[model samples]
Target: MSKRDLTDKGTISRKYAKKEILKTIIGYLVFYASWMIVTFWLLYFFEEIPHFDWILWILFYAVVIPFIVVLVSVTWYSYRYVKMFSFEVLESDIIIQHGVFNR
Candidate 1:
């Protein structure tokens, strides 16, 4: 909730936070740009692309489905990596923490 609490969890150095914030921003920008490209491509090529009879399903499955899958996959990685952080590192132990937002 606050900076103190966040620091209490782990030390996110300024350099690390700045780097990750840049990465997160760039990632979202890329996703937004891709979504724009897809939308515009579909809009401009609607008549050109053959839809047969299943227009709704075809449009969704052909364009939207793959985009959603890739977007989720990429965003998940970026989100997870956003906080340049470490939590309770044990002495020579092996583990990975699963979380979102890293609170």
Candidate 2:
């Protein structure tokens, strides 16, 4: 596609693209750090309790699985958001488009 066509279709602004990339990186880093800390804390806590295997298993399914699901969802959503949403600064006005179907 031509540059004009791409811009008109809201392919994205360079500034916004960089910002979004940075945001995604920072979010993942924070998520991983928090997950590690929480995992260690839970392991230590469960170790203190007698016969906590069941509780550990329960927590694995309830907390860990959901946490993983949420992380995956957020990553996928962010990727979609970045791909689908874009801004174009025209001389007359700013143009924004979101969603592959609509565009």
Candidate 3:
């Protein structure tokens, strides 16, 4: 399928550069990794505290798993986004279209 916008001078439609996908993935990875480090560090710190042993398992199940799931979901979404993304330069305006949920 093609995403298009009409223009008097005709449309210049293009997909995002492949490098953009790599760049975005790297950025997200760095951000998530830092947060994850802090999260796990806190879990470790708390686990060392007296009577806080259960905090590790509880937080692991409640926080760590969800964070990992979100990370994977976002990565998949970004990859799909790069594949489907397109922009059309019209005579008077530009229209960009891409959606992971609805396209």
Report the number of the highest-TM-score candidate.
2
lDDT agreement with native, every candidate: 0.55, 0.62, 0.59
Q: Candidate 3 lDDT, tens digit per residue, 2-80?
A: 3354653322222343455556666756775777678768867888543466656755776668657766776676566
Over 4 Å off, model 1: 1-11, 47-103
* TM-score of each candidate structure, all chains considered together: 0.37, 0.46, 0.43
- Order the numbered candidates by lDDT, best leading: 2, 3, 1
TM-score of 3: 0.43
Error of 2 at 102 (Å): 18
Candidates' RMSD to native: 10.1, 7.1, 7.7
Candidate 2 per-residue lDDT, tens place, 1-103, comes to: 3345443444644465456656766776677668757876887888854357876776577566866676666667656666777666555665565544343
Residue 44 lDDT (model 3):
75
lDDT-better candidate, 1 vs 2: 2
What is the lDDT, from 0 to 100, of the residue 102 in candidate 1?
36
lDDT of 3: 0.59
